[model samples]
Target chain A: MIVDSLPRTTLTEIAGMAGGGAALPALAARLNIVEMTQAAEDAVLQPKDAGRWPHALRAALAARIARQNDCPALADRYAGMAGADMAVADPAVAGEAEGLTLVCRFMDKVSVSPRDVAARDILELQEAGVSDADIVRLCELNAFVSYQVRVIAGLRLMAESVA
Target chain B: MNDVIHKFTRNVPDWRPRVTPVKLEDATPEQLDALQVTPSNTKVSAYVLTLAHDVETLKVRSPLFNGIMYDPGGLDRAARELSALAASVLSRCVYCAAVHAARHAQLSKSTEVTDDLFANGDKADLTPRDRAIFDLAYGLAGSPPAATPDQMRAARDAGLSDAEIVDAILSSALFGWANRLMHVLGDPVRKGAA
Candidate 1:
């Protein structure tokens, strides 16, 4: 697929893979993966059935994860999509006012120190009245952003190598 | 009840979800479709059923996962498994590490690499090639992604093609997605054994 037509949120665009930026010939072999990645971003960030988490909140969380990964460009993009939840895009802003203090803590731990997450973490969420399904929804959002941030970072490193 | 496995091991352990999995009988049409619950294939793992709560992401992720890992002709299967293991180990996702480590051993037809990995971790003794691949994947798996141009050069110097390097990135990044789900949503345990 042509790079121009690719979604702006895609790694191809976010990592500057187009226009002589990391456009390795091998990338063509995985066009399907690229496209599916955009589709995944949509599914996670703006799904038709967003469950308890609104699209804006998901976008804020996505930005927060991107920032934690130090991908400012990607974080900026997600922050733009956050709308009213934009404050939460800043990792420093605890989501307490938004009634998301536990959610934010859970997301931060899962994103930065996943190894330390334990059964008690899930128990805390459940105790706070977060449903089982909402917990799953939060995880999918956090997990997808983690994947996206790494891919963009990897692509940028690839670009730098070729440059 | 079962004891959660704290340390990494090559033997794949049972995954126990901290949250309740969606009951098969109560699944909606969309959840059922995403789960691919055919009459012939009714047995879904708790991990997958738990994911069915967000069927939209689950649907797209399943295919993207298979395409990255199982699609032919980029990085070799064993090498892809190695990348996956690198990410899982860094994330400390015991379930993911075990499954991918076993696959790496099976595909490479040797346990030496995984055994060393489980023993020495990031300091695992490896060939120049495996070291380059593991280092790249491990760096990429970090929160701030520490992989540098030098590491990319090392991979090329180790004789990895651009295609292989891309595959390494994808396989490792894919686990960045998988590890959070498996490690956060559940525990790896010895089923039926305390």
Candidate 2:
């Protein structure tokens, strides 16, 4: 929806620029995005998480995501992976493009019609007895920030227990 | 609503509210005044970081959400107003809903869309773009599991970019947090109901 409303040429140009493929290696090297990605996958998939490996790995990922403003496409790839679709449902290269396209559409709609109730959401969590500080900390979770609405809501629940 | 409600129950073992539903005429001016404010306890930092992400989303990723938060060059103001409207309604925050409803009227040369957003939640007759946004708001506010691959694909078919989609998701997530805060603090004051 948001995508449809945007200038097609702009989307094309952006896609083309990203597809030039120069940024991937740079991104992979700069943040160890590739290694981090692997580590994250292992941490999530393996047992005995006990919150150690996952915590360290997430901290690493969060750092990279914080710098997402510099290279949105790369950020898009990583954030998108973390957000909704982690990898192409189909293994084909075209599937990745299609997946990216789907992510783009979803993001456009959200960006356009964002929820402006940060104050209220926090209050609800706190009214439920979550602490003010913990509420703030939960909001810092990049997964919650990047489109994981359930994760955000879950964070509120998690915060309630800790707070 | 039930899931969020359940989440609260599971999290707060000792939490109990000081509920006091005052009648309109009996309510103190202070209570009514507080309704208009975002509240000191509301997490401002969370709001700021999410807004910053939204700015980056628009500037580098997609034009759809580029100017929603701030507008120097003036772009997407109407759409932003629409977003604000959707955000408030889904949030069920009386204060935010009223404010953004007025904003939608001021920005648009019409009131039909705003009216729809008020009367209907995600079922409003909006453009494909706004519709997608509405869907996101509902998912973010109510049940996020509803944001399945189908929902994602619908937006994609409608032409959204990866950047824009991520922005939208972040925005929805941000507001979801915001709405919960507002609701927990207190309901908003109606235009002149107090």
Best by TM-score: 1
CAPRI grade, predicted model 2: incorrect
Tens digit of per-residue lDDT, candidate 1, span A115-163: 8999999999999999999999999999999998888888788878873
Candidate of highest DockQ: 1
lDDT of 2 at A67: 32
The local distance difference test score of each candidate is: 0.91, 0.37
Q: Whole-model lDDT, candidate 1?
A: 0.91
Writing each residue's lDDT as its tens digit, candidate 2 over B81-186 gives 4544555566455544555566667677777887776666567788887776566545545433245455555555666544344345434544443443334433
